[model samples]
Target: MAVNRACHLIEELGCGTVLNGMLDYYPTKEEVQKVTVNPQRINKLLGVNVPMDQFINILERLEFKCNLISSDKLELEVPSFRLDITEDADILEEIARIYGYENIPAADLEGNATAGVKTENQKFMDKVKENSIACGLNEILTYSFVSPRGVDKINLPENDEKRNFVKIMNPLGEETSVMRTTLIPNMLNVLATNVSHKVEEAYAFECGNTFTPQNGLPVETKKYCIGMYGKEVDFFSLKGIVETILNNVGLKGYEIESETTNSTFHPGRCAKVVYNNICVGTFGELHPDVIENYNLGQRVYVAEINADLVFENITLVKRYSALPKYPSTSRDIALIVKDEVFVKQIEDIIKANASDILESYKLFDVYKGSQIEEGHKSIAYSITYRSAEKTLTDEDVAKVHDKILSELSEKLNANLRSN
Candidate 1:
């Protein structure tokens, strides 16, 4: 609109004179010439018969019009004929631009901000954090990138995703060139940092994603990792922490069988936390060699929980019982069982034979010594029985005892020793 108006105003005037040349009032000589030549070229390019004399006078008149337009639009008339604004349409568009976005009405949205509840995956992460914290673990944050060479220090899965790292095109340094595949490396780095700073007794946890390449595509997996460093940190400490975490996350009544699964941890001191027959996580003492490689302050208790598996469809159903009103009998029975037998199997057998009056049974002693035969060990279990109905005669107790012995002998092939 402004370009057509300028051309019309110039056509009204009759003189072939360059109207404006002062640097302050207009542009440099070359810039003024470029702007002045535009109308003439437009006439030639479009084959419009625009007289130079008339266009010159029209430009002179436009100086006043330009002042009025500039004042009305609150625009600064700079002197440069910038290449960006070489086209008349560009100049005209700028002069006609308006700021009225506020005049537009907003469209209604379907869901409000209150609908932002955590998704299933987020809920899993929340449970992991909550349970870990409840087990005396402090949440921690660390950078996802680490030194590529540092990965060789970790004893992870042989065909681990860590072997394939995402390298940065432009990194701060080699130390931060590759994205970490597991939280353990970054966690160990943090521990080393604290150790260097003379701080000890650290218990930290992180819930984050690890990157892997699956069939030539980048795959990110989220895991919840925990590390504990202190003089007292050991496999049992990590076990207790994992148990507490699982319980808090509605994973009560689950089991952790002592089993060797990873090289980063002590083989004999490790166990997998299982819920609903699925392995949710692991607990163990960090391998002494790994500790030395990372230069950690002390032996560390470590556990990693896969948040996804922690929240199985298991329910936290619980029942309560009143205190015993009658006298309770406590008896310890030590039996020899084959190494192939699991304690849970023994417990199942005990529960099967014992009456409902059986209050509790616990395995307190296990032995494979000179006094015991090879490949067989003594498993000492404490059994407590109390009758909810009555404190009957010795005959009733003896009857149940005999039944327990018979069941053990028939099922577990056990010998009952009365000494």
Candidate 2:
């Protein structure tokens, strides 16, 4: 496992292919100054007993090249090809002792075998990008590194699991020290630049890997970041844009609630877009603080959806919903209930009492006034009742209506408005 892991690291570091024949020879060092080495990793994984002379002979015979090394082996110039190899003699010993070259086929091979169809996750992202592009969203690319101030400004959790990124060995400066916990900060940067250049109504999205902690390991999550900037942008417009994206991908029966607030959004204007009852992403008006931080001139409404959450919600076949053959009898009722009484709770009570008769329900008005008690609001809802079997009659609806009013009164202590 260690050898394979080392080989993988070497490959990632742009060392030649893992096979012995493909391995690039390190240049001889001009000076044998003590190079800082990760002694444990090197000794346990790459220690060798082969003579340095024999290793040099093997490399020389293969016409393998290296940096300047004197005959005495006292000092040698570091080879550019050996950038990934940190320790002195570690690279040479690894080449000499590790021997799997003879067994590998000499010819270049093609991976033609169909690796089962693209995973559902992959197809979902493809659909996300495709739909986003179709809706006039441009693809964006940004760095993962974020500054401390930037992180704080974006209101990231101090000990956030996602913010625990792999730190650089020697970071250039503090400004680029930490890995980004969220995409909003960088997206805001993009927005600032575009606004400065006089771009109007920018619609952009990005899909990339982000590092977050999972069981003490930095797990890479492939995430999609979306942003929108325009003078006229607002909550519902962005909601419409997101609905188009979600509906196109067939993740139906999702819900959004304005209660899910984030530091990046206007407190009353943000919503958490939930799918399968999981908090997947958010949509809202950019907070005044965020707008000022980015020096953005126009208001921008933005949303981000977890593509993985989306794909998980994807179904293999579309479920069908029958159109109402009978007219939906909708009733509007305004209840003066305590502010603490959730409209959702009242709606749920109505649905529970009405059983299958309630086809759909929506809250169209929420009022607070001197006519009502303090700390209480009047909520008005239009609930459409229908029956699957046949047209629902007024008498049939009245029976369910009485049941709904009774349930609401009992559950929420709500009083229905009287004419």
lDDT of each: 0.68, 0.71
Q: What is the per-residue lDDT of model 1 for residues 19-126, given as tens digits with 9 covering 90 to 100? A: 553335535455342331244344433334445444334444334122222212222233443445454554333322321224233555557556668986677677
- Give the Å shift of residue 341 in candidate 1: 8.2
TM-score versus the correct structure, for each prediction: 0.57, 0.59
Candidate 2: which stretches are off by over 4 Å? 1-112, 115-118, 133-137, 145-148, 170-178, 198-200, 213-217, 229-231, 252-261, 274-278, 297-299, 321-327, 332-346, 362-382, 405-419
lDDT of 2 by residue, 135-163 (tens): 88899988877665775665656675545
lDDT of 2 at 197: 91
**For model 1, what is the alpha-carbon lDDT of residue 236?**
57
TM-score of 2: 0.59
User: Clashing residue pairs in candidate 1, if any?
Assistant: 9-58, 10-58, 13-54, 15-53
Residues forming the 10-long window of minimal summed lDDT in candidate 1: 64-73
